[model samples]
Target: MSKIDPKDIQKRMDRISEIFSDIVSHAETVSKTRCPYRNRHDHCTAEFRCRNQQAAETEEAPLVCGHEGEFDYRSAWESNPLLHARATKKLDEIGKAAAKRRADARRKKTD
Candidate 1:
C-alpha cells in the first residue's frame, strides 16, 4: 500500500470538521424557533401536547404543526395528561429516595 500523506489527511479532517460545524450551527439556529417535535413535513410527531398542534383534516392523519418558526418553541410544549403523570411519577420517586435517606441517617444517629 502507498504511504499516507499526513498533510492530505489533515486537510481532509479540516474539511470534515468545517462541514459538521456548519450543519451544527444551522441546526442550532433552526432549533431556536422550530419545535423539536415538528417533523420535516410540518407534522407534530410528539405524543404530548403542544400549543401549536392543530388537528389533522382527517382523523387518520397526524396532527399538523401550526408553528411558523416565528416564536420561541420552548413555551409551546404545553402540559398533557401523560406528561403530567410522568412528572408526578418522577416527583414521587425523588420524594421516596429523600425519605429513605433521612431514615437511614436517623438510624445511624441512634446507633
Candidate 2:
C-alpha cells in the first residue's frame, strides 16, 4: 500500500479544525439570540450582556453570582428603583389620558 503524504494529512487536519471552529462560533451566536428575553428588535433591554448565554449554558443553569434561570428583565429593571418609579409614572399619565378621552366621548354622545 502507498504511504499517505504528511503534507496532505496536515492540510486535511487543518481544514477539519477550521470547520469545527466555524461551527462552534455559529452555534454561540445562535444561542445568544434565542432567548425570549431578547426584544422584538433583538436587543437586551436589561442593558447588560447575558453571561449564561456567553458561556453557552442554559438560562436555568446556576451562575456564580447565585442567580439562576433565564435573565429576568423585569427583576433587572426593578432592581433599579428609579426605573420602576418612572414606568409607574408613565402608566399613570397614560391612564389619565385614556380617561379624559372616554369622558370626552360620553359628553359628545349626550350632545
Could you list the CA RMSD of all candidates, in the order they appear?
8.8, 13.9
Q: 93 in model 1: Cα distance from truth in Å?
A: 15
What lDDT tens digits, residue by residue, belong to model 1 across residues 1-111? 999999999999999999999999999998898887888899998877888899999999999999888889768786765777798899999999999999999999999
For each candidate, the alpha-carbon lDDT, in order, equals 0.89, 0.60
lDDT of 2 by residue, 25-79 (tens): 9877755535444544443434333443232156653332322434543443324
- The model with the greatest TM-score is 1
Total backbone clashes of candidate 1, pairs 3 or more residues apart or in separate chains: 0
Ten-residue region with minimum lDDT total, candidate 1: 73-82
